[model samples]
Target: MNPIDPQHRNDWLLRAEPVEGVERIEAFFQAKAYAMHRHDTYAIGRTLAGVQSFNYRRSTTHSLPGQTMVLHPDEPHDGHAGTGEGFRYRMIYVQPALFQEVLGGRALPFIEGGVTGDPRLWAATDALLQQISQGLDPFEQGDALAELAHALAAVAGTAPARSTGDFASVRRAREYLDAQCHQAVSLESLELAVGRDRWSLSRDFRVFYGTSPYRYLTQRRLDAARAMMLRGVALAQVAASAGFTDQSHMTRHFTKTFGIAPARWLRILNGARATEILRNTAA
Candidate 1:
């Protein structure tokens, strides 16, 4: 796709290359950008210009530039431009697993109202929310995630984990699932591999990871499929390779997880890449 025309009042989204446990996007919208959808990742961001509005948690909220928006996992929400002038924003979708690592099994933070003007959060997100072209090194990213996680916990008034669950066994189970996501995995198999009862494991996994075991496994598969798609792989091939039953099965899950079809997702990504190349050439 050609680089978006600045004068055209069309919506455009630019996605950064996915980093571990995080995805970043910068976008501008003249009208509605998304339908009501939920995903199992923390949607944290800042509105850079205009009025960024969304219907979240049964109410509509508007965010102005310099405000922080924090939407918890699996929260139903839809986004659009609040005013005639439209909206522009940058966002990072962080897997709950990364926050779990920092909180060590504490409940994920909840920033009521979906947006904040908290100075701590504004500062915490600074490093990770830089220009999409200015990517962070691994160490920098880790530090930023940690800082953001702590800031969220503090803001939400959530205490650190009290060392209640079998954190070690849960970690092992998570690692096993990560490695074996491409294959059929059963509760029995997970039990044998992690040396824990299925019920206990299930309980502890949710306590530590903020999601169920099945969800974590499915997300791993989805992550693989996304990477494959980015490489211009055929959808059918990607489906089979990523452990889905078939193309339709993968497409269903992909759309449910992302709120957009796989093909449209690829187009947006390609458009972003094209825009980046054009910018580099002009520079």
Candidate 2:
């Protein structure tokens, strides 16, 4: 079957147990059937086979074997098969909290166009993803998570000017931010909390974390909103609970980041006749 349009490609999600902080998903794509939906976790995946098409940022993107699709958290996106064979992919949803465990509060790395061939990224990711797709020892999962953190850092971070992975200062800042994610955070307060100057901590955060403090906070909010919408929350309530200013504000960023409106997410999650709505639309 020929793939359908981007607007309605994502009408379903088959969820699996979350690995580490990531929610694992194995999506069976119609020639093209996933609609736009962004998640709080970093969306990383390798297409098992077929040509997977997605509209991301402002472009229609495609992924093939050996190409790592790095969809930064909080961006809007959707997926489906662009060819007759259809597409299958496994996704690992990594939380910013886990990524922060490595890099602190810095800006998360954004690999352009949702793809990369950096050896560092490839090496760091291959194993963890493999284990999630298959089976692994519990102790091994722990070790892989730690290595994955460092590997992600190596690929995403700049060479630190000081060249030291200063632990105490960065960790303190992370602890404070995590504890206060629900509260307004300030530079001066973070400086005191981390025992480093604001600029240094912020710099290190970007270097290690792959995203900035504010963006991290927004990701957390989006993550929360995603869960709520999946459970049938009203837009106004989801906005408030997810820490947005209002429904309109949430809608703007929600569609911008996830490629679908709250109503659609709620409707889909409720299993409200989507198979029918998209039956003719499915490839």
The best candidate in terms of TM-score = 1
Top-lDDT structure, candidate number? 1
Model 2, 13: alpha-carbon shift in Å?
1.4
Candidate 2 has what TM-score? 0.64
For 1-283, candidate 2 gives per-residue lDDT tens digits of: 2343455455444454454556665555555454676555578877766687888899988888777888876577887677876676667777766766555544456677887667776667776567332665556656766676666556676343344655457666767776776556778787777778777776665555545566666666776787877667877998887778888988877775656666765565445245544664785
- Give the Cα error of residue 22 in candidate 1, in Å: 2.2
Candidate lDDT values, in order: 0.86, 0.66
Regions more than 4 Å wrong, model 1 = 1-8
RMSD of each: 3.2, 6.5
Report lDDT (Cα) of residue 110, candidate 1. 88
* Model 1 Cα lDDT, one tens digit per residue, 1-283: 1232357466677888888878899888888877777777889998888888999999999998879999988788888888887788899999888988898778778899999999999999999998888887889999999999999999899876766788889899999999999998998999999999999999888776766898778878998998999888999999999999999999888877777788887886687678778879999
